[model samples]
Target: MTKKNKKDIFSSKNLNKNPSEKNTYNIDHVLDSVFGKEGTKKRELNRKKAMVLFRAEDLINERKESGLTQQEIADKLGKDKTYISKIENGKVTPSVDLFYRYVQAIGKRVEIV
Candidate 1:
């Protein structure tokens, strides 16, 4: 795997491009060029990782909507506030146990599909 396949969700060119520019490349072309062609192992893994990050973002939003402070969640989970902060800020990935506790902290439950 190339270094890019490991970390980039989009090429730097795409990220740095001006939104007001007249033209942009097709998303499929950009993704394929950055990660790999569709069905490649790296592409699949990158997509899954992207989904995880998206879910982590959703978790942060949901927690905020629940009106619970990070400190309060940390207290409920018997962890330090930094633990919650780390997870919500995308600095750490929550373990399954932590994920459940997070959902439970805000009066929600995880339903595996």
Candidate 2:
């Protein structure tokens, strides 16, 4: 084949036609391209969202471990159960003080790293 034909055959656009093609579009690569490098402005937003999700997951797990009902935790925190539910669902970011209180209430240690 001519060089131009070889290049076209190896291109990502043509990979779909060849099931055995080794070099194809990578989802991670595409995401990186769209979101920019980590710590960059675009990725910072993604990082914040991920942190909120992690916080929510941690809160739920801790509450379960402490055998606390949602209402109970809410009562201890002097907040509404719906507010706690929203935080656990990652619908909102809890204030630092509130987050610390949550950890304390669950008898868990909060490590800052």
Candidate 3:
């Protein structure tokens, strides 16, 4: 038999379903399709959200583990209570140095691996 054309190959029974439309709940795959393989504005926004959530959660957990309140953390960092609130609420993105300071205030050190 002759080799199928590229269109014919892609037009196979299953290839018609787009990756985003497929029912796979895998986050990476969904993100790849939605944001593109590299990244898009929408994807970058979503990435920011995810990063904020992660950082907030990390901060919250560290504070809890160290038995410190937001006020206490702010005191340690010489910041206002609202500053801590904003960080924990994902309403702010801290600079790298500020993040290090915040994490240190909670009695933890940042590790790069």
Top-scoring candidate (lDDT): 1
Worst 10 residues of 2 by lDDT: 23-32
Error of 1 at 25 (Å): 7.7
Candidate 3 — which residues are off by over 4 angstroms? Answer: 1-38
TM-score of every prediction relative to native: 0.67, 0.64, 0.63
What range of 10 consecutive residues in model 1 has the weakest lDDT sum? 9-18
Task: Give the alpha-carbon lDDT of every model.
Answer: 0.81, 0.80, 0.76
Ordered from best to worst TM-score, the candidate numbers read: 1, 2, 3
Task: Write model 1 residue lDDT over 22-90, tens digit each, in one string.
Answer: 564446756677667899998998887788788878888888899998899999999999888888877
Which residue pairs does candidate 1 place in steric collision? none
Q: Please give the clash total of every predicted structure, in order.
A: 0, 0, 0
**Candidate numbers, best lDDT first, in rank order:** 1, 2, 3
Q: Lowest summed-lDDT stretch of 10 residues in model 3? A: 1-10
lDDT of 1 at 5: 63
Please report the TM-score between candidate 1 and the true structure. 0.67
Candidate 2: C-alpha lDDT: 0.80
What's model 1's lDDT at 43?
A: 91
